[model samples]
Target: MTDYAFSSVNQLANDFKDAIKNADDDQKKVLKKAQAKFSLIERNYQIITNLYNNNMVDEQRPLYFFPSSQRLVAGKEEKGNAKLIVPFEFVGKKLYYGLTATGTHDLNPMPFNPRYPMVGLHANALNTILDNKLIHEVSKAWVVLIIIILGVVLAFGIPSLSPVQGGATIGGLLIGYTYLCFWLFSSQHIWLDLFGPAITMAVGYLGITIYNYIQEEKNKQFLKESFGTYVSPELIDQMYESGEEPSLGGEEGYHTAFFTDIQSFSAFSEKLSATDLVSLLNEYLTDMTDVLLDNKGTLDKYIGDAIVAFYGAPIEIENHELWACKTAIIMQDNLELLRQKWQSEGDRWPEIVHHMQNRIGINTGQMVTGNMGSASRMNYTMMGDTVNLAARLEASAKQYGIYIQIADTTYQPVKDQIVIRDLDFVRVMGKTEPAQVYELISETGQEPELYKKILPAFHEALALYRNQEWNNAIEAFKASDELEDMFPGRKTNPSRIYIPRCEHYRDNSPGDDWDGAWTLTSK
Candidate 1:
């Protein structure tokens, strides 16, 4: 019976060898045959052990076909079709090994065919065995650690930097990490993964950069829409550079207030069609407004035929009063050019349109300047007594037959830079305190030849009128008017307007306490 049992076991082993040789490259078939043969050997372990112990050559030979057996003398129980050994590729060859666990490492070959143990296996399989869960867990932990560190850095750091700086920082991190991984691998033979951490940082950088780009564009659009029509491009650029929004609340500051209106605009409105009126008004406004913006003035709003603007708010100008004075003269000069252009158009415009005139008033004082109105609707504008006086001056220019009127405050700071004439010392309709008003004639050295001829007699006439010498004042006024008439095509001189005033005062004299300050009853 023992002989028969030995024959059965030997026959089974021979059949397993035959199956492995016949299976060739079929690893699953070889594994199936090995399982069957190993199962029988497990059942008959005492018989095989006794044969091998008795020094029989065939039985004593090592069964290298069996996988490593630190758990048992033979195959481990693979219940539910779970494999105890696994197949892996090595050096372009297929081989099998016992599955790796926490503390087990066996690199010795496990042959598919017992006749040739080295045929289907490689010596490099030892390195493959070492590439196990332990190494993978360490690599994965390293990757996670790298990702966490870089994520924290990029989240906090990238936003503070500009686009170019952020990009360069990302580049430096990637290059530095790549070099670290390569150095570890080359110098220490550590297999730290490059692809995982590299991809994570790259994705993080791209996401942050895109988000910053979108937010920057949003801020830029907001600035453009908010201040585009009110402030100059240069001020808008300054706001963008500062990365701050203008305050919506009112602020009190020293500013120069400006107001302008077309002279006899009501007559033009009566004469022209609505479309032609709008066209003409738009052309005039565009030309005048360009000078204001060019000199860094903030436009407040238009009131029919009037333009209201200011300087030294939202952004401060170095010499805002001076700038306002310069802009007024430039606008008048531009109006003259437009008049010439309209005249050459050959009566497409009316004769009155060709002779279009406007009045400008400027004052410098403390005022409230900011976005004003309800929450849902607002206008960036100016208010206070200064602004009111500026409007009053604009309305009162018609009385003096003048084109440009400026308060004494506006004239004092820029008096050396511009040519101006003292028009009057008067209290406008709304105010209690009287202000000295002046006519802004031209920039220094740019006054007309006619001003040179009439100004001497005009100055004498003004002094006599202030002295209350009505008779001499009337004669001096007429002389100045005659001098103005010498220059043909001149507008009605201020001298001519004062003549009747002198006549009236001569007839009904002001009291002895009269301070030579006229009180205007109308705006």
Candidate 2:
């Protein structure tokens, strides 16, 4: 069969009518053949009209049609139309019997199904418009709300999950929301924003996930550079996992500050060769630094021949003062062993190097800790009066001929756990207020009870000294010196410094307004 357009079909119909009117046998035979061919094609391929015609009563539906030669195009608006015009696109394109793959221009019916290519699409559109069943999209407010909900839900959920799980979550949400879109359109003729929500969910998930990964990587690098040298890898991991950043600002915190410096280090360095000094210093520092970090101390810095550190920073340790005291004791114990090791390696340096001792100072109080330095170089460190006192205490340790000294704030926390001696309340240079400093002896306060009698006498002497009774204080201090029979560990005698001061005070009595606080003229 041949394809036909609305114009060609009209021309053929006219030819048949006029040829018969002219009365010619050959023409009649040609017309008869054309009519038979048209009939045969119509019987085989013509589709039933899908539109409810205005000419027919609404209750009386036509189930079948007798194909008419004049009605070539099923897309005609009416049976009584006088105008012969049609869309140019449909001029040569064949009208389908019922949407066949053989031809094009099948817009008559919807594209979802292959039926009624002539009248189905038009009838469907007309029916939708007529019945008020046109799908109306959800409001802009609803769309925005849905986007936000999906974006928030996926953004939060994705980062907390593994990559595979996050992908799966996005996929499931997209599919589920799309299904809801289809269901709403079918059931209630609603057109929700399926594409919008799906895209928002996927985009939000990926954006948040990637951002978190990058931030985590950045934090790993930062934490490594900031603390990698001193703290253990495990501690680093703990800090990193906590997800707290150490930024450039200070905050008040209760922490224990620690400082240490070798005694006569300048004199010892003078004797050692440059190479030997560096080698010895490296070894000494490595061992001591490990002990400090093991006790959860953040190594603030190394000053020439000293180590400065603190506990309860970057990460808080509950018993920071106790840790500081224990770390001091540990450092002393470790240093003794190291000295023995150096002695065994004879000729490494002067024999006097084996007797090297480090003085330690610790204090506990409210201090400021964070990144502090010039714009070019920032140091994650601590500052405040508490920190200053700890440094001063380190210097004062040498004055008392002792290894370690801590302020009263530190002593109160570890008195039960450590053996200590009450030193004195003295005003260091640069400060107006007097602070009580004590010497830390050992972890165990229970021992030979060697300083028991001397401690009581020393307290009495200190009390007398504080009362401006210089003669009585000197007498009490001398009795204390006589009572101490045990070998002094770090100091030659605890009462020596106090007695000299008491003798001087007795020789020249002070005027009124003496708070009994000795002020050191030097740092």
Please tell me which predicted candidate would have the highest lDDT against the true structure: 1
| Per-residue alpha-carbon lDDT of candidate 2 for residues 161-279, written as tens digits (9 for 90 to 100) | 87888888888888898899999999999999777788798778778878878988888877887888765566677788876655568878899999998888987778998898899
**Cα lDDT of all candidates, in order?**
0.80, 0.78
Best candidate, TM-score: 1
lDDT score, candidate 2, position 168: 89
User: Any runs in candidate 1 off by more than 4 Å, and if so which?
Assistant: 1-137, 162-172, 186-189, 467-472, 485-491, 502-514
> What is the lDDT, from 0 to 100, of the residue 207 in candidate 1?
93
Which parts of model 2 are misplaced by more than 4 Å?
1-157, 160-218, 230-235, 444-449, 452-454, 467-472, 482-491, 511-513
Model 2: C-alpha RMSD to truth?
Answer: 15.8
Candidate 1 C-alpha lDDT tens digits along 60-92: 333335476433233444542322321110225
Error of 1 at 260 (Å): 1.0
The TM-score that candidate 1 achieves is: 0.69
